[model samples]
Target: MLDPKTGLPPRFLRTPDAARFLGISIRTLEKHRTYGTGPTYRKIGGRIVYTLDDLQGWTENGVRRSTSDETPCRVFPARPLTPAEKATL
Candidate 1:
């Protein structure tokens, strides 16, 4: 659904506001999205949107008591190599 006032998604935050909520710059957020490390997002009407809950939950993924604490970030697997592909490598 669209917001009657701004015509934007009503419940989710845009990139800028979501970035502010996370205390990060828009570019960083964009990079996260590119690298599959950012908070969960929805592609509504072909536009990106982030819910408050998802943002908060993903943020908690990095929570730790000490600076050295290890928190895993999302990662994607590389494409599988075929028999011929393996020969090239």
Candidate 2:
């Protein structure tokens, strides 16, 4: 479990350690890391490292509102605001 009290990154885990800790196959973790879809990690030299905290964070439990109450999200590129919107400044 992630020790929030410490807030320090958990001891780093090798691919096998991380896989065993999370009860998954190392190949699965490897696949996600390659595509950037899984828990955060660090790459040292040629090795991948996972933190206990990242594993714990993946399992945190907070309820999201139902789809009926969900708001559609709008994504924008990182750039200066449009002239019309900037006029308020």
Candidate 3:
């Protein structure tokens, strides 16, 4: 469907589409959701959906110039954070 504001496809994407857009497997996306480590999503009428902007923003969190770069924001794995990791956040 086209978005009234942008005259393009709607920004919202379902799980599989969102995962493909991010180049990750659907199972990985599900894992991220289960662990609460993925992009921000909306629950609309019992469905979970991600916005294109949110997907891009989440990927941007992992951007780095070098291995030693220290960015405050990061895109973590699709799993629970350890105590030490939680402390850093």
Best by TM-score: 3
Q: Give the backbone clash total of model 2.
A: 0
lDDT by residue (tens digit), candidate 1, 1-87: 568999886588989989898888888888788757678899999989999899999877766788776555432222344689546
lDDT of each: 0.75, 0.64, 0.90
lDDT of 2 at 63: 27
Answer with 1 or 3, whichever has the higher TM-score: 3
Clashing residue pairs in candidate 3 are none
- Runs of candidate 3 exceeding 4 Å displacement: 1-7, 87-89
lDDT of 3 by residue, 1-89 (tens): 57688899976999999999999999999998999889999999999999999999999989998998987776777899899987977
- Evaluate model 2: give its lDDT: 0.64
Write the number of the candidate with greater lDDT, choosing between 2 and 3.
Answer: 3
Report how far residue 41 has shifted in candidate 2, in Å: 0.4
Model 2, residue 52: displacement in angstroms? 0.4
Which prediction has more favorable TM-score, 2 or 3? 3
Candidate 2 Cα errors over 4 Å, as ranges = 1-10, 61-89
